[model samples]
Target: MKKWVLAFIAAMTFSIAAHAAIEVYEFDTLQQEEQFKELGHTLRCPKCQNNTIADSNAELAQDLRHKVYEMTKEGKSKNEIVEYMIDRYGNFVTYNPPFTLATSILWLGPLAVVVLGFGLIVVRSRKNKQVATEEKWDPEKEQRLKALLDEKNDGDKQ
Candidate 1:
C-alpha cells in the first residue's frame, strides 16, 4: 500500500511538471495581449483548413504563433503582421484578403455559377414547354389517325 501511494504521487508530480513545458509569453500591456489574441483568431493555420492559429495545435500553427508574438514584441502593427503573414502564406492565411487579379476567381466564381444555373433552368423550362405544346390536340390529325386505325381493324376483321 505504501509503495503504491508513493508511485501515484511521483506520477502526479511528473505529469504537472511536464505540462509546465508549454511556455506562454507575457505581454507588457493588456491591449497588446488583446491584439495578440485577436490576430491569432483572425489568422488561419497554413496547414489547417478550418482552424485559426489560436485554436490549432499543428507544428505550423505553433510556428506562426511564435512569429506573431515576436513581431508584436518588436512593435509591429497588426496590419504589418497581417501583411507579413499574407506575403509568406499567400491569401489563404487571412480571411479578408485584398482584391487582386489572382483572387478574382474567389469573388466571381459563385456569381458565375448562379448565372449559369439560371440560364440552364431557363433553357430546360423552354424545352419542356415546347415539348408540351407539340403534344397539344389537333382535331384534323386526330381524325386522320382514327380513320387509319379503323381501316386497319376492318382489314383484320375481313
Candidate 2:
C-alpha cells in the first residue's frame, strides 16, 4: 500500500539521520596516518572522563582529533603534538603522564600501600606468635590446673 511505502521511506530516512557521520583525513604518508591514529588513541577526551579521543564521540574529542591531524600534516613530531596537547589540556590529556612532584603520589601510592600491608601482616603474625607462646602450658600453670581437677574429682567422689 502507499501508506506502507511512505512509512518505510520515513523509517529509512530517520535511521540514516540518527547515525553519526565519520570524518576522513587525508595524509601524504603512511607514517602520518599511523601518527594520527596513535595520537588519537593516546590523547584522552577532556569531555569524556575515561574515553580516548579516538573512541569518544564528543565534540571536544572531534576538535582534538582535527587538531592532531593538522599537527601531523605540519610535520610535527609525535612528542611535539603530545606536549602541545599536554600544555593545552594539562597532564590529564595523556594516558602516560610524566613523573613530577604533583604526580609522585600517583606513581608511589600503590607501592607504599603494598609495603604498609606487608608490614601490618608481619606485625600481626608476630603478635599472634607471641600470644600463642604465652598460651602454651607452663609447669606452674599445669600443676595448678591438675590440683583444681583433683579437688573437683575428690568432691564428686563424696
Candidate 3:
C-alpha cells in the first residue's frame, strides 16, 4: 500500500509539472474557457464545503470537470447543464439549492428554530411574572403555625 501511494504521488508530481491539455475540439473554443471556469467554481463537492469542484483535487471533481467541459463544448445552455448536473447529483451539487416546498424547510429551518426559541422565552417570562403575583399560603395555615411558635415561646420562658 505504501509503495502504491508513493508511486501515485510520483505520478501526480509529474502530471502537475505537465501542462493542462487543451483539447482542440472543432465545436469548443478557447473563448468558452472563462465561462467554464466560472461555472466550475460555482459547483460544490458533495463531500466538502467552501471548496469548489474546480479547486478540489478529488477524482470525483476530475470526472465532473470532464463532464462540464464536454457540456460546454456541446454548447448546451448554462441552465441545461446546471439542470443536468442537479438531476445527476441532486441539490448537493449547487452551492445554493433552489427554494421550493421540499427545499423550503432546509432554508427556513434555522429561522423557524429561532422563532420557536423566542416563543419559549416569551412563555417562560409570562410564567415567571405570574409566579410572583399568586399568593400561595393559606391564611388558616399561617395562623396555626404562628400559634405553635407562640406556645413554644411561652414554655421556654417558664
Candidate 4:
C-alpha cells in the first residue's frame, strides 16, 4: 500500500512538472502586452459569468482571449475592443456597464432597497416604542381580569 501511494505521488509530481510552464504571448511592444493582459482581466467570461477571461478555463473564454489578442495585434484601441465585445455579448461582458435606461435598474435597485429597509426599520422601531410607552394598565380592567380568572378556576375545580 505504501509503495502504491509513493508511486502515485511520484506520478503526480512528474505530471505537474510537465505542465508547470506559464503561457507567454509575443507582442511588438510591452505596452501592447500589458493592454492585452489588462483586457483579459477586465473582460467577463460569457460562459463563466462570475469569472474574468483571464481566470476562466471555459472554451468560450479561450476563444475570447484569442480574439482579444488578435484585436490587440490589429492595433484596435481598448475602447474599440470593449465596444466590439459589448456589441457581440451585450453589456454583461464588461464589469463596468454604461448607465442606459435598461441598466438604470441595476444601478438604482440596491439604493431603493436600502432606503426602503431603513424606512421600514424606523417605522417598526417607532411603533414599538410608542406601544411600549403608551400602554397603561387600568386598575378596573385588572380587577375584572382577576375576577374572570378566579371564576374560571372555581368552575374548573367544580
Candidate 5:
C-alpha cells in the first residue's frame, strides 16, 4: 500500500537526518589522547558562543577538531600549540586568560556584583523594617467619633 511505502520512506529520512557523531580516535594512544582532550577543552569554537570547539557542532568546530588531530599527531608541545593559537587568534579565542593587574578587575567583577547586591538588599530590608505605623489621634476627634458611633447604634436599635 502507498501508506506503508510512505511510512517506510519517512522513517528512513528521519534516521538519515540525525547527526551520527562519534569519537574520531580510539583510546590506545594514551599520551596523545590525554593531550588532545585537554587541548580540545581549551580551544573555543569560532562560530559557537562560549563553547569549546570539541563540544560544539559548528563547521569551525569540525575544522578545529581536524586541526587538533593533525597538530597532536605531529607531536607539537601543548604549550607551543596553545601559544600559537593565542598568537594567531588573540586571547578571546580561548577561555582562559593570564592573571595580571589589568585582569584582576575582570576576575573580581562577579564577586563585587554579588556583594553589592547583598548590601543593597540589606539596606532595603532595613528601610522596609523602619516603616512608621503608630499614629496619635486627637482626643477631641476620638470623643466625637465615639459619640457618632454610639448615636448610630442607638438609632439602629430604635
Candidate 6:
C-alpha cells in the first residue's frame, strides 16, 4: 500500500512538471525567431508592474506572447506588430514609448524639476551673500562692541 502511494505521488509530480513546461514557439526562419524574442523583451507586460512580456507569467503576458507568435507566423513586420500592440494596449505596452506631447511630461518632468530646484538654490545663495555683505561690521561698531564687553567684564569682577 505504501509503495502504491509513493508511485501515485511520483506520477502526480511528473504530471505537474510536464504541465508547467515552458511554451515553445516555432518560426520559419532564424530571423523571425530573433524578431519574436526581441519584441518579447522590448514589450512590457500590461498586467505586471515592470516586467517584460518575456519574463512575466501573467495571463495577459501569455496572450500577448501568443498574439506575437501568430503575427510573426503571418509574416508581419516587427513595426506592425508593435503598432498593433500600442493601439491595443496603449504606449505603456512598450518599454520605450515614443515621445509625444502627451508623454512629454514623463520624459522631461525630472529635468524641469532639477532646473527649478537649482534656480531656487542659486537665488537663495545670492540673497544670503547679499545679506552677509550688507551686515559687514564697521570699525566704529566693532569698537563700541568691545567697549561694552569690557565694561560688562569689569562690572562682573567688581
Model 5, span 109-139: residue lDDT tens: 9999999999999999877776643345689
Q: Write the per-residue lDDT of candidate 1 for residues 29-114, one digit (tens) a residue.
A: 88788889999999999899689999988999999999999999888999999999988999999977778999889999999999
Say which prediction, candidate 3 or candidate 4, comes out ahead on lDDT. 4
Question: Clash pairs of candidate 2?
Answer: none
lDDT of 2 by residue, 15-125 (tens): 998796979999999999999999999899999969999999999999999999999999999999999999999999988889999899999999999999999999999
RMSD of 6: 3.4
TM-score of 6: 0.81
lDDT of 6: 0.94
- Residue 3 deviation, candidate 4, in Å? 14
Task: Note the clash tally of each candidate.
Answer: 0, 0, 0, 0, 0, 0
Better of 1 and 5 by lDDT: 1
lDDT, residue 152, model 5 = 55
* TM-scores, each model vs. reference: 0.75, 0.75, 0.68, 0.71, 0.58, 0.81
lDDT of 6 by residue, 1-158 (tens): 99999999999999997887689999999989999999999999999959999999999999999999999999999999999999999999998889999899999999999999999999999999999999978999999999987775754686
> Relative to the true structure, how large is the alpha-carbon lDDT of every model?
0.90, 0.94, 0.82, 0.93, 0.81, 0.94
Give the poorly placed runs of model 2, Cα more than 4 Å off: 1-9, 12-19, 136-158
- Segments in model 1 whose C-alpha atoms lie over 4 Å from true places: 1-21, 134-136, 140-158
Show pairs that collide, candidate 3.
Answer: none
TM-score, model 3 to reference: 0.68
In model 4, how large is the Cα lDDT of residue 51? 99
**What CA root-mean-square deviation does each model show from the true structure?**
5.4, 4.3, 7.2, 5.4, 5.5, 3.4
Instruction: Indicate the residue-level lDDT of 95 in model 4.
Output: 95
Residue 158, candidate 1: Cα error in Å is 24
lDDT of 6 at 104: 99
Quote the lDDT for 95 in model 3: 84
Residue pairs with colliding backbones in model 1 are none
